[model samples]
Target: MTTQTYLVSGMSCGHCETAVRSELGAVPGVQQVEVSAATGRLTVTTDGSVDDATVIAAVDEAGYQAQRG
Candidate 1:
């Protein structure tokens, strides 16, 4: 498994966390997703290699921004 952490922006509530989690969870190879709106942090666990672009795009789809940390 691979674990990655990202710094996300514009997350201010539980709903934001949910959106980020749902989007990241949809990514191929993603096994788990953890997000904290308070901290604006996102962590993803995957069964295989997952690219930063994919994760960033997922966050964008969730109506937020993210960058690998």
Candidate 2:
């Protein structure tokens, strides 16, 4: 498995985490999504290499911004 962590902004609660997770979880090859609003971090585990742009796009769709850290 491959894991990537991104720094996400504008997340302040569980709802925010859920939104991010839901969006990221939909991405192909993603096996798991773990997000923390308090830490402003989003971690994704995938079976293979997942494009950074795609990950960021998913975060954007969740109403937040993210960049690999």
Candidate 3:
């Protein structure tokens, strides 16, 4: 398993976490998504190589911006 963490911006509430989680959870190979809106952090666990760009794009689709940390 591989785990990646990203610093997300513009998340301010539980809805933000839910939106981000939903989008990331749909990505191929993504096994889990953990997000904290208050901290603006997103952590994803995957079973294999999932491109960072893909993850970032998923976050964007959720209406936010993120960069791998």
- The candidate that achieves the highest lDDT relative to the unseen native structure: 3
Per-candidate TM vs. native? 0.95, 0.95, 0.96
- Model 1 agreement with the true structure over 45-69: per-residue lDDT tens digits: 9986888899999999999999998
Q: Please give, for residues 1-69, the per-residue lDDT of candidate 2 as tens digits.
A: 999999999999999999999998889899999899999988899987788999999999999999999
Candidate 2: residue 57 Cα off by (Å): 0.2
lDDT (Cα, tens digit) per residue for candidate 3, span 1-69? 999999999999999999999999999999999999999989999997798999999999999999988
Please tell me which model should have the higher TM-score, number 1 or number 3. 3
How much lDDT does each candidate structure score? 0.92, 0.93, 0.95
TM-score of model 1 vs. true structure: 0.95
Residue pairs with clashing backbones, model 2: none
For model 2, state the Cα shift of residue 39 in Å.
0.6
Candidate 1 runs further than 4 Å off: none
How much is 45 displaced in model 2, in angstroms?
A: 0.3
Q: What lDDT score goes with residue 64 in model 3?
A: 99
The TM-score measured for candidate 3 stands at 0.96
Deviating ranges (above 4 Å) for candidate 3: none
Q: After superposition, how far is residue 41 of candidate 1 from its true place, in Å?
A: 1.0
Choose 1 or 3, whichever is better by lDDT: 3
